[model samples]
Target: MSEIVRKESFKHVSYLWDDDEAAKLAGDEVALLIYRSNLLGADLRLTNYGGGNTSCKAYAKDPLTGKEVEVMWVKGSGGDLGTLKKSGLAALYVERLRNLKNVYRGIEHEDEMVELFNHSIYDLASKAPSIDTPLHGFLPFKHIDHLHPDAAIAIAAAKDGKKITKELFNGTIGWVEWQRPGFDLGLKLKQCLDENPGIRGIMLGSHGLFTWGDTAYESYINTLEVIETCATYIEEHYGKTRPVFGGNKIESLPWEKRKEQAAALAPILRGFCSSERHMVGHFTDDERVLEFINSNDLERLAPMGTSCPDHFLRTKISPLVLDLAPDEDLSDTSNIKARLVPAFEAYRALYTTYYETCKHPNSPAIRDKNPVIILYPGVGLFSFSKDKQTARVAAEFYINAINVMKGAEAISEYTSLPRQEAFNIEYWLLEEAKLQRMPKPKALSGKIALITGSAGGIGKAIAVKFAEEGAVVIVNDNDEARLAKANEEFGKQFGKDVYITAKLDVTKDEDIQAAFDAGNIAFGGIDIVVNCAGLSISKPIEEHTDKDWDLLYDVLVKGQFKVTQAAVAIMRKQAIGGDVLNIVSKNALVSGPNNAGYGSAKAAQLHLSRLNAAELGADKIRVNVVNPDAVISDSKIWEGAWAEGRAKAYGITVEELPAFYAKRTLLNEIILPEDIANACFVFVGGLLNKSTGNVLNVDGGVAMAFVR
Candidate 1:
């Protein structure tokens, strides 16, 4: 079956070319040059909505007076390439931009430095240079373009972006990880150029694409061709899954009505930012828009933080995940406005609290809370800026970000850096100054994770997953033999450093706290959790006693909650975000028969996760769920008399149980422990930093039985 793939999926640094034509391009024709810039600009596949920038050096007679001066016609910092006219471009002394990156060694005063950079630009446009001007300056080539291309970034965002880029670029291009995209990027790029004098292009992981040439057209054409290659590569490897938009569910509104809705929502959203007057882009991509609008959890899952680092200086992290429907436009902007002001205020409060919690005693002062982006349902996304350009850039970046998010969801899961980690990236001066930086989400080092019930199957898989990814794993189980078996297996498979086993009844308070304390002592702090220790009691409501309900609650719901509460104490004390994963069941959502106590307890577990999420969000604690179905593990109670009894009671043969279960899902497959482990990884790792109160269905679509 043909899968749905992102339209523009590719690697960025593949544009490195070094032929005779590239070696001698000073005399390239002007029309050719214009075409080149436009083609490079048209690489919206790699660079949509002018997200990337390009510059070329030229000697021109002053239009106002008749004096010749050499300057760079750089794409204006915030204009969309889709409609970037020549007149919209800015002119600054190339020598000055280069000197700024080169001569300015270590300027401490930000204001003074801004002033010095301004002095370098003789033109009175007063427009700020692209934050990446230093990157352009440091590159040896005369023609340069930098873009946050979707195609290129698709590869860059991968865990193996560097390895992929190396395979793609081989010896011709260089690669960097995602870094803060200004002076830091420039400095890193400067070093790269020095080290690889023959390097023709640079690919920044998790950021976007960069290409340069001696002439404008060469750089542009090379960027396009390379992006195309990367796109083909992605299509071949990760062939996309085409999730259809089941559409025409709602009536389409006329343009006049749409305009009215846009106007109504604009003013209130404008209040979130300093921009008084705003421009709103109304889109009818309702079917696609509503997918996210309705998915409260997706909002929680998305990196809703700034689309990129440059956006952070303007918008703090991201706008509140707007709660809305895809096709339903916000009819009352005023009401949303009322809701948003408080939300922004809350965001600011949380931001301040986070700073207090995480900042060192002698750290630099944190910046102010200035909102830059605001998301609205059915209306696409809004970028708020004092100028039309910044607002437009904001909108474009947001749209691209949403697309990337959508694509990421179809894959495994898309994650972002943790809030505190992002804060460090946003504020670290040394981190901020390197041009060749690719900012990685922090690794799982210096962190600990506890997996309850890990001695068996699902929990065991999750424990191994965490350990493989560098986190110290604490495996918990009530059964000493099973726990020891897990410890032995992990030690033999991955070595002793990866796994540690302890016996504990998750329901016991002392056991819960002791587990956490031991984990803290072992791994410095508890950062992740996988609560897979729930007892599944297969009994119909009539047959189930109150005692059965209580036991289910104690083991399935309260036990997980207590363990999480204990871990949270350590996590809060350390001031780092903590993640808790409740391994519930598809039976929580869907049921045939004989799952009363189990299902009810699982329902309670879901509620518990959400409550803790809301309560502990301020403490940087995240709580979510992994709903697994029909697992073949030591924890699979169906193997016991009760499960067989349920099958017989329901008039189903034991041989038909798995198939009977498989028919319920859109995808017919067994729900494996590794499947649960993958979803767990998203929750614990940097990817799902902002994700809380989420229910990830590891049930192979079986839960459709409930919704249907």
Candidate 2:
């Protein structure tokens, strides 16, 4: 008989709270309670600047009358949860906030929203109630605590997230798909409660978990218990591995030396910070950081993925792994600037492509196409904030997230929330409002994407795919009439705001950058890049020429490298994660006749894709290759002369080519642009978040099937 394997239960954490002190609060205690809330904000991991929010509901008597008045002391807008003051927690009529939820769905006017906002009894000094007032009011519980717990999210990001959730919650939980968190979320929760009357808490998909209790401590305990349990489960099942990003330990360094390093790198901060108040700097251990610098695989893996979307608010996607000689001195900043500029340009190009592909005409323009913060090998992270506090808060969030991602990746693949889903949440008004209430320490809005070779076929398909998700796409091709017609057809279904046309050569760097710059200037920054620009020439090696090889390399490999390099630079400056997808042929891996030059060029492109992925990983720049075959189109292989020659060589009629290719695959069907487009979006978006330096084959199972 097989031995019975027993699964383990989750461990819970006890929050240290002074119960007697908390329960003894009277009118005089309001000041102290508010003060305590502010103290918690200093721990940026929990509440980065104005991330996690807190509130207290109480009944107080009117000054002039004996009648009881019910009010909620909630954190105010623009107040960091860590450094909040007694006055920072606004006193608003609880009845009014509850009332707003009833009317929120029906009201569509901005004026009414502004009017309702003004009615609250906000502290004369602080900002409005934290954006979570609606969520708080809608909850039946008196006190509520919400946080984007990194541990919980790390568990939630696994391949078996659903199974884990079932294990953790058992049957007494409610799961809600990610929705704009506001009045809509409130209404949805109410419906969920109506269905599952006995549920203890809810988990927001692609977001985080929610728990509450009658008292503050109970609520806090509930939140911690959920996180602790998830963390323990993850540690046990996944088997905990030490963080790949290294530990928080810092070696002793002289204050003067640290200051000197900070002084040398301050200019990079100046461009993105846009102000001095938000500037903060730190230096890392010389030996440990260089360990990553020394290893090629480590350099490639570091920036391969993000811990969470929240990281964008700080370190963006990745950091720069500086070039250092084995015996060279550690304090050199000479090579830093040279690397920084080109990295920023590459980031911009990617950012532009992402923005163009994702946004429609109605979407807002881009903003801050440069990274607001950065981390360098042998140096700690640096960020520009509206104020010093902001910089620290942003850095803290990213640092923890980066650590979590590295740790998570060690156990299994580091996955990301799907790109379309991330876009939906990012653009959702309710979520943005919550961010706005906190001064939005990190800026990620208004980015564009420009997809080239997009006039019908895979290029056009990818362009439309990005548009539906959230990006303003600039479609380009050599065929003007075809380009115009494809745009019109796509526009009729998606809308006119979906596409812009550019008749230009993909081989020219200036042409690509100019198109990218125009798009970025129109928006603010570019966020994603998909290189579907390619062509195939099928002639025996003897018939191929130096000119043919050069043209093939220029289109398939060199063009993509140039475009990707430029895009990475912009994204680095913007401090945002950018994606690059190269459309290479499956023939590179498994070859066919008279296609040596084409296959060889594609192989070179595929290698460049990985090299780029390795070099740019630290900048939050990801590069991957897509290998597709049997994509029926007007390529040289399917045309008149080539088809006739191929038919004669194979001793089969030209009409049999489609069936021959299709039957060669496990699934007998001609691959379409739409199929390739689906894979393209999945990679660019967050579906393959933890994937880079990966070669994904969307060739209809051809990799597994053998040809007769």
Please list the C-alpha lDDT of all candidates, in the order they appear.
0.62, 0.59
User: On residues 450-554, what C-alpha lDDT tens digit does candidate 2 reach at each position?
Assistant: 666887678878777777765566677767887788767776866643345667578887678666654433233356777877776667778888988898889
Residue lDDT tens for model 1, 1-708: 111222233244233223444436546433334445555555445565545777777676666667886776666556666556565566677667666655555533322344455655746763556566667766767778787665566566655666777787774668876666566577788787788778767877667777887766567666766667666566554425543222223343454554444444443443343322222221222344445544444446443453345334444566555554434445444455555667678766776776777775545675545455555444444454433333455555555555455444344344454566567656655433432253442356435678888887888888878777766777888988877777778878876445567788987887776676555333334568778886666766688888888898889888887888777765554444678888877776765677777777787887888888889889878888888887764554666765576567668887777777677577888777888888888777777788888888877775453432
Cα displacement (angstroms), candidate 1, residue 211, comes to 0.5
**Which candidate number maximizes TM-score?**
2
lDDT of 1: 0.62
TM-scores across all candidates?
A: 0.44, 0.49
**Model 2, backbone clash pairs (residues 3+ apart or across chains), number:** 59
Candidate 1 shows a clash count of 27
Model 2: lDDT equals: 0.59
TM-score of 2: 0.49
